[model samples]
Target: MMDWRTKLLDPTPHARRDYASLATPVYRGSTVLFDDQKAVTDDWRQADNGYSYGLYGTPTALELAARIAGIEDARETFIVPGGQAAIALIYLSYCPAGSHALVPYSAYGPNKAMAEGLMRGLNVEVESYDPLIGAGISDLIRDNTTLIWCESPGSVTMEIQDVPAIVKAAHAREVSVALDNTYAAGVMFDAFAQGVDVSMQALTKFVGGHSDLLLGSVSARDDVAYAKLGPIYQQLGLAVSPDDCSLALRGLQTLAVRLDALEKATLQVARWLAEQSLVDTVLHPALNTCPGHEIWSRDFSGSTSVFSFIFSETVTAEQVVEFINALTIFKIGMSWGGVNSLAVVYPELERPGVDFGGRIVRLNIGLENPDDLVNDLRQSLGSI
Candidate 1:
């Protein structure tokens, strides 16, 4: 009895729908339907209250958040646009305009950048500290100190932090501790069990597995932390794509298998590199030569594929570029945790006192056979 246009806009389902599939449905929408006017409300606590709006997350994103929370044993997890967004969320949530925070010198570069750029502009004082400082972090805490950040087997240099010691020091001062847990994939290390207030990961890496997506997660260890983060998350509107969430779900299915294979192949390559005459230091946490390797052994259940090694002083920075160009299988690029191996030289990489002087190269071992990867490295090193 209505016009065809009216029929086309009908909200009723046209097909019988009792069927189900193992895959998480890719739910995409900007609007959510309410049963009645009384049921409509906007709340970001989708895990507890029913989902209110698409910006908070449809079912797809909620499922990914739930899975990450389960893996980390957290009270809740918030899905964001990328790993950087997760860092911003935690900073904005805990470090107010006038507060002070502590971060390891070896944290993800963007994290330090945020500390100097955005947080500084907002009047927050973020101080970089030694990754191995451990309980000494207590001395750095001031009356206004609110957050302490740890990144184990840190960015390029792979300096592992004494997380439990740092946590104890911060808790005594009634300060919060947050960790960049992306290196561990929320599985290799237990962030919540270590007494961290929040644990964040770049799901783009291990959780997405195939280098096909960009996503991140910020998880709260308890209800107190959850209550602190939720409102800020809503205000920021850090929504993620449902398609990416579906890929992450698929990645989770094979996560354990992929990790097992990656660990074996990576250790093989790292050990081979450690023995090479051209290599000065291999920064794999599983190896004893790395800084804070003892702490990593105590805190981590396993190590993953990405790590770095420094060229012996005998090799010049220019030769590092030549070495990267000579590689056959290990492609020259940045961003790790994928199906393909990667190598990139950090000519300007430095700490407070030590300088790599363009001689450090970071590697992300892929699913390639260990022999082939080792051969690739050998030939490349020979060229240098």
Candidate 2:
């Protein structure tokens, strides 16, 4: 008879079993010892043999990377200190001096900043285009254009991009596409299957599921992009702490359960918000009223618990503050993908490039009962 536990623990032929009596073992160290002199010399080059040094990767990190790679159905995956670092590593690897990259206008705020600040400093040109540009992106691609970046159901405005159209446009121009998939995580969308060259996520969010660890992952289709990014990642000297990787691993075990609860509760809350008299618009891609609902429905399997809504003109700033302050369940905080519900008010529109205005509120639906959350919001709105 076969042991189920052994099979589960070592799913891959290359994976070695550790007898440690823990769900996931934490391995931490800076220097790794070799069994022999030739082994030491050969290990220095690493060259696909596992575990060269602690910083290169520990068993803890490799286990998490393997799990993520398995989920993405990709050849390889690498962990970074944070989500932004994962994005930066890709840029550093593929985009060289004088190269141009196109990014979605509504992409993550910090990602936009990276393209504007650091990418420019590296002599790379970063262009921000409308997420809905779709096939029109072909017009924007120049000879130097190296990459087209996309973020489905953009972070702030939550607009679902026509990914296939954009991918076709970019491919015609011989450009690679990178998507910041933090919002949908891997549960809702398959980036590789959607023709994305690179898929990245801030594991700190839904993957961590506890709002505790800071981690990020980048998955690539073939060895080309993965090989290109690997050295840069190692050279950058970025590594997730063993403890954080272990936490993310634990979070992955329950990701299916957490995301299911969040999806159900978030939709309920979004629908209620849509009907509220004090709401002018709800910017959830999962809702049919959103701008790119058709595209979202077409490309994505599910939506995350995060979304935004705009208050009606009659709702004043004072009232908004009153509503947020009066909430008993939704905590006012930034960052999401946790078991607890959170609420935050953002400038109605993004600044400098795009503006949705200042009347918008972002919500992260948690594991709380949908009825209780609705009641809290109703009471808070009544106070306003």
Please give the range of 10 consecutive residues that has the lowest summed lDDT in model 2.
39-48
Per-residue alpha-carbon lDDT of candidate 2 for residues 1-384, written as tens digits (9 for 90 to 100): 669987777634565565666577888878777777676632322436856788767888888988988898877888889998988988888799999999988888888899989999999999999888889999999999999999887886888999889989998988999888888876588888878888889999999999998999988778777877777877888867999999999999999999989999999999999999999999898887787899888888888899989898888776787788899999999899999999988854564454444678899999999999999999999997
lDDT of each: 0.94, 0.85
Error of 1 at 80 (Å): 0.4
Assess every candidate by TM-score: 0.99, 0.92
Who wins the TM-score comparison? Answer: 1
Worst-scoring 10-residue span by lDDT in model 1:
11-20
Off by over 4 Å in 2: 1-22, 41-47, 351-356
Residue 249 local lDDT, model 1: 94
What local lDDT score does residue 35 receive in model 2, on the 0 to 100 scale?
74
